[model samples]
Target: MPDGCCSHCSDFGLVCTYVQPQRKRGPKNITIEELSKENASLKAENTSLKVKLLSLSLCSLCSRPLQSLSAQANSSSVFHRSTPESATTPPSPESPEEPPDEQDFTGDDLAERFGSFSIDSLKTKHFGSASTFALANNTLAMKENFLGRPLLIQSRRPLYWDVLPWEKEASNQGSDHVLKFPATDLIAALLDLYFTNVHPTIPILHRPSFERSVAEDLHWRDVEFGALVLSVLAIASRYSHDPRVFLDGEGSLSAGWKFAKQVLTIRQLSEPTIHKVQMYLLLTLYALGTSVPQLSWLFLGVGIRCLQQHGEFRRKPGAHKPAPEEEVWKRAFWSYVVLDRTNCVFLGRPMGLQVEDYDVDFPLEVDDEYWDWGFTQPLGKPSHMSYLVLHVRLCEILGGAMRRLYSSKKAKILMGWDGPEWEQHAVAELDSAMNDYVDSIPPHLRWDPQNLPQGTFFDQSAILHITYNHILIVIHRPYIQKNERPKGPVAFHLCTGGTRHHSHREYVVL
Candidate 1:
């Protein structure tokens, strides 16, 4: 219409012929250019989607699957970006170590799987069972996640001093129904038994000072310290054969429970002290001895946190200069560690404390008398003190194994291992460590039925032997599922050896 293109053709009047010219096409390059623009847009959109997914994965609270995918994608990108020579070459053995990392808590793997944030996963995955999250946070908190991870028990807006129902039985000090104290004679007997039996194994308290406090009723003045005194009496009563040792028509079990309730009344006191720590430990021990392991394990966590608050693990160097208080605290901390590991093993739970977190020294192997005199006596290789030291060392190893092999994070990682060979290797290493621990025991402490020592020394020997076997069983238990161990050989050697070293009568007595 405008220039060369024909709109219409007409010949003059009649009999005119018309013809259409061949059409000319535009360049094909324009079409290809349009297609290229669309392709670039699509690639950009796909890349944005992938980036979004990776970001979401990074910020996710507990999306394990997404995190794994993101990690794989990232590692792949890193691998592809490497130079051809580096990609083809194997890692050199002489490459510098990465400054000896304390632990590997990479983004993909978090070590604290049972901290405050894990309550939901715990309830969902574990069902009705008590998970480590539940134990660390209160079991009540697990049920009601909104309650949050509070250390003390709560009743409405403020935490109540007395959390347990039984604690209400205690009356105001000046009230008509004031709580009564145990008789002096009963107190004397219980203290005697405690010093004679329990103190040898766990010498956290100084005997003379404790006795003075008890004689003067000094501890009874403060509610928290009073609870500690009551707990000690209650624990000591367990070793007593006489019913009269338990005051107010209470049995040994009831005595402990009554004191436990009193302790609960002061459980949430704003300040934590050494006496309070001791009270919690005694309560845990009492619970364990009575076969209430759940309660024991729970209280063990409480004690551990309390100890941490007191900075027992973070001792001030030279602050308590020349005083044996430092030594006492060290022993107390290790005592808690041993009890913590023991309870965890019994309950099949992860440990609340880790050895790497502690920076305290082990108590010196010396007589308790020397501690009272602010000096340490030279120790023989195979003395009672040596046995105590050896027990702590072995307990540390047991705790390490529990952490390495039984932790939630570690278990999750190992479940993805290529084969069962890794598990076998881990179990074998633990087995060797345990054997070495036993072999390190001095000759005199080692059990001998034929030439057994007199009194409690012989009893300690038998207990040690039984304890060693118990730990062995604990370490090797997972292997039972796959029939990786010959239970008969292990059982036969330990059981028969222990029996030969300590009579069947002794086993019954225990």
Candidate 2:
């Protein structure tokens, strides 16, 4: 046994074994050399591990405070992500000096830099120093004077259908003519899509009347109804996700041939009718769904004008009892009401048609087939009409919130000290109203995991729940922005529940 072998083995508690002796070297020397090599490798590994630990410990400023990061990102201002090309380059003289530590950059610094600029200017003017803080690499790069607000990268929209080469190419020799009108099969598919998917939720048109128009080929016979039919197809196109028919869901104006025709016709409509009103409503919904809220708001105004022209707001003078046509008009009027109030809440505008000015009761909860005649009784519990009634009730709640929280005058009033109290009370009332609305829903309409029904009927219940959650988020979002409503799960629940479970089902049947 070697003298130092025991020392090495005793320290590490590793047993030293016998080895073949070299010419002049014994087990002691061999063991010492082996121990030295093992110690060197271990030391290198420890040093490497320490380097890794240090690198892992370092986090970017933007990565830690996600709530604050999201708040800053969601602003309508522009933010710049540092490309790999930009990151490796030497700092330019134009770039502002970055703070040594994340702590050195205070919220006050953000305010001082941004406080003077108007939102319009902020949105329009390109800020030089809007370098994006990326969480992926935990990297920070300073830009010029302004700190960049985080923003989603927007995709380029397609060119308008008029500008596309479809017409020009068709005009050239040896090319097939671009479609001037929708094909029979395409129209059939679109109409089927609308009736099966879109109509169940909204149910604005009388199905019997619409089918009669379809049977007569009213789309070609009546220009106005033709325009309205095109709008219905446009809205239905959104649900199709069919590449040939709907080229882009985001830019509907530039996508489908039928949608473009609808827009052109609506723009040139010299005389407006109830059909025109219906067309505008469907167009507004398509616009809103396709990320063109301003256009939706504009269409809302046009639809309201047509409705008012037809005396949709007041009951007819000679009729003691409601006629079938009268009932359709009432349903149409309330559809406008639902849309206008919801749009106003989103756009921060005053309600165009106040509830106080109207006196029509909700349309009877019967299927559209019964609108003109036959079977006044509902067929099933979760029928289309039940969804309509629930939607109307939701609209009523939405209108109340709009009047209290989102009206331009109300918004102005909310900027004062009394705003907090008003906000709290209003939010509470809305929350209470939403709960009651959900409670008021028939047991069949309420969602149940154990008793999930098959088909689009499930969609009504899902829509109710999703819309309720969405409304809850909208109502409490201001409070959430103010750091109140910490317990509110509306946003998270919507992302998880609304999108994951129901959003696919909402349009799948259509």
Candidate 3:
């Protein structure tokens, strides 16, 4: 801008031909040189502002929505430091070097902070939450909302909360009285279908324990556990070729809606237990499998909320179990987490639950049958739960990929990542982590296109490989140009993985 090309363009190797026009061409005390110097100064200021705007638009893909309300609350200091004179200075890398902590939402009370906004506040924080219909209708609004992602449970309209179908079904005696476990003859077939086709992939429920409970007919005596059984029946019904699965007047893919609906009707979330969590999680799977995906979110949301209540917030895993059902809850909770995160990425929705909110460790890798007994990790055989453990760990990485590649720009900026190079580093770190995870998988559960594992291992292998490829596809999805075909094998592997999901001839490819 020194009476010629501007400095802003020089950094980008471009020459700006912008020149300040003479105002009125009137002679004054200010010399022509002074006027030229002032115009050049203004040009430099504009360029600095443009660079900052460009970074905000391109560098931060998901940065806007998840921005910290607390940061906006404190941005007055940032804005105040920028005097009109500083506009002529070049943009500094240090400005975003030390951003406020995102989790600092816990400390700010909107009511107390009213003083700041009314006094020295620059009005930056007035409307992040409010703009998105996230008004603080309750006393715990600060704790209730994080950045802009909210807890799904709080999103329900409070006025109609009590009238939700689940609420009314609480007193309904429909499924509680009518639906008994299928006559003794049908139970075997449904349970077989569930363990054979479904349980391998989920592996959240303890098959031996569940079978023992059924043998004793104990599930029928307890309403909550009975709901759990019904959920299992609903999920397994999808895999059943038996006519009994549809004796209730529903057809294929909907063979067990009654049982699913019954579980929803009877299992009030008022008392959160491991059985309740498992019930909701299975219901979520059932909803998806039955092609009623609209219901999956509700089921998943309830399941996660219930899992949070079991004190997972404060526990850690050791060599052994915590209490009677502690290990069960832990396994089921992770399954719920995987489901929640998978849904977020697959559907492009925000995460329902962040990993930071809980502290429970992954379930021990021992087979569920031996989980009760000590270190009896099946000798010379594949542990039934090992595949599931690997899958959960893989999803943890997927969650990280989402945060790293797809989370708000504000998050990356706060963390001091300022350019596309940060993304490359993140991708490399994630790719390395993925490689280690694949390597760490036990031999039986590893992906083998030639000799896919059999029986229990089959479904687990299919899901693990499918999810592995799915994560690869997700991580590199941005690099795929708009409306263009992928130029690599990620898509091919995903296609093959889909074919491997089921061992049926149709799902098998030669």
Q: Could you give candidate 2's per-residue lDDT for residues 372-408 as a string of tens digits? A: 4532655564456777878878978877766666556
Point to the candidate with the largest lDDT.
Answer: 3
Q: What is the C-alpha lDDT of each candidate?
A: 0.58, 0.59, 0.62
The deviation in Å at residue 407 for candidate 3 is 2.3
List the pairs of residues colliding in candidate 2.
129-144, 130-148
Between prediction 1 and prediction 2, the one with superior lDDT is 2
RMSD list, candidates in order: 18.4, 24.7, 17.6
Cα deviation of 309 in candidate 1 (Å)?
Answer: 1.4
Give the per-residue lDDT of model 3 (tens digit) for 219-304. Answer: 76667677888988888787777777774665685687767776665534244556667888888887776565767888888777
Instruction: Please identify model 3 stretches exceeding 4 Å from their true place.
Output: 1-178, 247-250, 267-269, 317-324, 415-418, 482-510
lDDT of 1 at 197: 87
lDDT rank, highest first? 3, 2, 1
TM-score of each: 0.59, 0.56, 0.60
lDDT assessment of candidate 3: 0.62
